[model samples]
Target: MPHIAVIGGGPAGLRAAEILAEAGHGVTVFDQKPSFGRKFLMAGRGGLNLTHSEPAPDFLKKYGAAETLMARAFERFSPKDLVEWCHGMGLKTFVGTSGRVYPETMKASPLLRAWLKRLDGLGVRFCPRHRWQGWEGDALVFQTSTGEAVRFTPDATLIALGGASWPHLGSDGQWANIFGKADIALSPFRPANCGFLVSWSEIFRTKHAGEPLKPVTLSFAGNEKRGEVMITEKGVEGSLIYAFGAALRDAIEAKGKADITLDLRPDLSQEALLKRLSAPRGSQSFSNFLRKASGLSPLALSLLREGQKDLPLDPEVLAARIKAMPLALTGTAPLARAISTAGGVRLDAVDDHLMLKARPGVFVAGEMLDWEAPTGGYLLQGCFSTAAIAAEGIKAFLAPA
Candidate 1:
C-alpha cells in the first residue's frame, strides 16, 4: 500500500484522502485548522450550493480558460458522479429551486459531520493543527501547533492548499511560493467571485446599504446578467455583481475605472418603457408615477441616483434613464473580501494527470490550479472533480501491483 499525504483538509484534500484510503492506501490529511471543512462550513452558511443543475458543456464553460483543463478532471467525476458519491456516502441531496444541489438536511453541518464520520470509518487519518512548510529533502515538512517541526516522505503527495482568498480559513496560498521554488510556474493570486466598489452617495448608503436589489438585471459593456445584488456601504455585492466581477476587475486593472450600467427593470424593455412613458402623467408626482407604473423598488430607484444629479423630468428622458442606469466603478473590493480566487499554479506546470512536471509524485487540485469560475455551485463542483481525478492519477502512478 502506498503512503499518501494530502496537504489540506479542505474539500479536495479530504476527498482525495477518502479515495486513497478506501483503495487500501495509507492516507494522511494535514491542516492548520482544528477541524476539517472550515471553508466548506462558511460556504454552507448560505445554504451550501453543492453543484449546479445545468447541462455539462454549458456548465463547463463557467470555468472560462480552465474549461479544457477542468473538463478532463471532471470527465472522471462529473457533477453526476459527485451526487452519486455523496449519496453513496449516505448523504442524499435534493435540488433547490435554482437547480443548486444540497444535502437533504439543507445545512452543511450534517453532511460534513457525516462525511467526516465516514472518512474516519474508512481509516483516513486527519492531522489537524499541523501546518505545511514546504519540503525538507524528499520528505514533507510541517510545523505542528506545539512548535515542533515534523518531516515524512510519502509514496505520493497531493497538494490542495486552496487559493489566496479566505486566508483565515487556513488556505493562505503560501504553497504557491513553495511550488515556484521548485521551478513550477505559478499564477499571481487575484480575486475571482468578488465584490466591486461603486462609491455610493452617503444618502444612498445610509438609506439603502445592506438592502437587497432583487429581480433586477446588471449590464456592463455588452454583457448582461440577471440576479439579486446586495448594496453595501462601501460597494455592491452578491451573485449578479460577482458574475461580472472578473470583467470589472480586469478593466480596473487595465485602466483606472470601469463604467457599469444596471437595469432596475430588466423585465421591461425600452420600447415597453416608452409605451409606459406615453401614458398621461396628469398631476402625479414622478416618484409616485414610477412606483405605480414601473414597479421599481425604492432601492432600485436609489441606485439610479448613484450617478443621476437631478431626476429626469421629461417622460422620454426618464424612461431612457430608468432603462439604463450608469455607475462608474472605482475599483474592486480587496481580495480578502472575495468569496474565491482566480489565479494560482499554472496549468502548464502540471501534465494531463495534474501532477507537477517538475515533481513526479506531487499533484495539485482545486482552486490552487489557475482557473476561475462563478458561484451557483460551480466552485464546489470544481473541488470534487479535481480531487477525484487527482486520486485516480495517484492510483495510476502507484499502480505497479
Candidate 2:
C-alpha cells in the first residue's frame, strides 16, 4: 500500500486522510498548528453551517464558474452524502430556515471529535507543528517544531494548506511562495465573504456602531440582495454585503471606490412612497416623522440620518433620496476578519482532477483552489467535495490497476 501525505488539517485534508486510511493506505496528516481544525472550530463558533439544503443545481451555482470542476467532486460526495456521513459518526444535523444545514448539536466540536476518532481508528497519523517548506531534492521538507528540518518521501501528496486569511489560526498563506517557485500560477489571496469599509460621520459611527440594518435591499452594479447588515464602528458587514462582496471588492480594487445604494423600503411601490412622503409632517422630529409616516425601522432611521448631508430639507426630495440611499465603500475591512478567502491557486494551473500541472503527484483542494462563494454553508461544502475528488485522483495515480 502506498503511503500518502496530506498537508493541512482543515476539512479537506481530514476528509481525504480518513478516506485513504480506511482504504488500507498509510496516511499521515501534517499541520503547522499544534491542533487540527482551528479555522474549522472558529467557523463553528457561530454555529457550524455544514452545507445548504438548497437543491443541488442552485447549490452548485453558488460555486460560480468553478461549478463544473467542483461539481464532479460534489456529485460523488454531495451535501446529502455529507449529512449521512456525519450521521453515521453519531452527529445529527438539521436544515435551518435559510436552508443551511447544521448539526443538531449546533457546534462542530462534537462532530469533529467523532470524526477524529474515526480517523484514528482507521490508522491515520497526525503530525502537528510540521510546517511544509516544499520539496528538497525529490523529498518533501518541513520545519520541525524543535527548529530542525525533517524530510519525507511519500508515494503521493495532497496540499490543502487553505487560503490566506485568519493567519493567527494558521493558513497564513506563507505557502504561496512555495507554489510560485514550483511554477504554479498563484492567485494573490484577498478577502472574500468579508466586510467593506465606509467612512461614516463620527456621529453615526458613535451612535449606531453595532446597529443592525434588517430587511434592507442593498444594490450594487445592477445587482441587489436583500438581507440584514450590521453597522460596525469602522464599516458595515452582514449577509447582504457578503452576498455582493465580490462585486464591491472588484470595484474598490479597480476604481478605488464602490458605490452601493440601499433601498430602505423595497416592498413599497414608488407611487406609494411618494404618497407617504406627501403627508404633512407638521413640524415633528425627523425621527418621529420617519417613524410615523415613512415606517422606516430604527436602524433605517439611523442610516438615513447618516446619509443626510443637510437636514431639514424639502420632504419630497428627502423621501426620494431615502428611497435610494447611496454610500461609497472605500475599501475592505481586513483580511483577518474575512470568513473565507477569495484568491488562491488559479484553475488554469491545475488539471481537471485538480492535480498541479507543473508538479505531478501533487494535488490541491479546498479553499486553496481559485474560487469563492457566499456564506450559508457553500464554503464548507466546497472544502469536503474537493477533498473527495482529490482522494479519487490519488487512488488513480498510485495504483491505476
Candidate 3:
C-alpha cells in the first residue's frame, strides 16, 4: 500500500487523510499544535457555521476572483454534498435563517470528535507537535516539540497549512519562507473578512464603542450589504463590513482611504423619511424628532454626526443624508486580528488537481490556496471542497497507470 504524509491537521488536511486512508493508503497527519482543530473549535465558540444553503451558482460567486477555479472543486463537492457528509457522520444539521448550515448542537466539538474517531478507525496516524520545516533533498523534514529533527519520505504529500490569520492557533504563515525556497510563487498575505479602521471622534468612540448598528445597509463600490455592525474604538466591524472587505481594502490601497455609505434606516424610503421629517417638531428636541421620525438609534445618530458637523435642517437634505451617510475607512486591521486571510499560493502555481506543478506528488488545499470567501460558512465549504479535489489529484498522481 502507498504511504502518504498529510501535513497540517486542519479541516482540509484531515479531510484529505480520510479520503486517502479510505482508499487503503497508509496516511499520517502531522500537526504543529498539541491537538488538532484548535481554530475549528474556536470558530464554534459562538456557533459552528458548517456550510451554506445557497444555490451552487450563487454560492460559487462568493469566491470572487477565484470563482472559476473554485467552481471545479465545488462542483465535485458542493454544499448539499457537505450537508450529506455531515449527516453521514450521524450529526444532524439545520439551515439557519440566513441560509447557513450548522450542527444541531451548534458546536464543532462533537463533529470534530466524530470525524477524528472515523479517521482513527480508518487506520490514519496522527503526529502532534511535529512542525514541518522544509525539504532535505526529496525527503520532508520536521522539527518535533523536543527540538529534534526528523525526516519522512512518502509516496505522496498534501499540504493544507491554512492561512496567516489566527496565528495563536498555530497557522503563523511561517511556511511562506519554506515555499519561497522551493521557488513556489505565493501572493503576499493580507487581511480578509476583517474590520477596517476609521477616525471616530473621541466622544463617539467612548460612548458608542461596542454598540451595534442594526437594520442598516452598507454600500461600497457597486456592492451593498444589509446587516449589523458594531462600533469599535478604532473603527467599525461586523458582518456588513466583512462582506465588503475586499473592495474596501483594495479601494483604500489604491486611494489611501475608502468612503462607504451607510443607510441608517434601510426600512424607510428617502421620500417617506422626508414626509416624516416634514412634520412639526412640536416640543421634541432635534434628536428626539429625528429619532421618532426615522427610527434612528443613538449610535446611528452619532455615526451620522461623525460625517457632518451640522445636521441639515432641510427635510430633503436630512433625509438624503440619512439614506446615504458617508464614512471614511482609513485602513484595515492587522492580519493577525482578521477572521481569515486573503492571498496564498497563487492559482497558476498549482495544476488542475491542486498539485503544485513545480513540486509533483505534493498537493495543496484549504485557505493555503489563493482563494477567499465571505464568512457565512463559505470558508469551511471551500476548505472541504478543495480538499476533496486535492485528494483526487493525489490519488491520480500515486497511480498513473
Model 3, residue pairs in steric clash: none
- In terms of TM-score, which candidate is strongest? 3
TM-score of every candidate relative to the true structure: 0.96, 0.96, 0.98
lDDT of 2: 0.87
lDDT of 1 by residue, 1-401 (tens): 78999999889898888888889999988998999999999999968788988898999989888899788877888899888887886878899887888878667888788889988998888899998889887899999999999998999999999998889997778887888788889889998888888778789889988889988777887988888989888888899887787888899999988887777788889888878867887899877877777778888777766666778767788778877777777888888778999888888988888898999999988989998888989999998889988898999999996
Better of 1 and 3 by TM-score: 3
Tell me the spans in candidate 2 whose CA falls farther than 4 Å from its real position.
none
The CA root-mean-square deviation of candidate 2, after full C-alpha superposition on the true structure, stands at: 1.6
Q: What tens digits encode model 2's per-residue C-alpha lDDT throughout 75-190? A: 76899999999899898899899988999989988888988999999999999999999998678999988998989999989999999889899878888999888779988888
* Cand. 2 TM to true fold: 0.96
- Give lDDT: candidate 3, residue 189: 97
Tens-digit per-residue lDDT, 302-331, candidate 3: 887774678888889999999999889999
Record all residue pairs in model 1 with backbone atoms less than 3 Å apart, i.e. clashing. Answer: none
- lDDT ranking of the models: 3, 2, 1
Off by over 4 Å in 3: none
lDDT scores of the candidates, listed in order: 0.86, 0.87, 0.92
Better of 2 and 3 by TM-score: 3
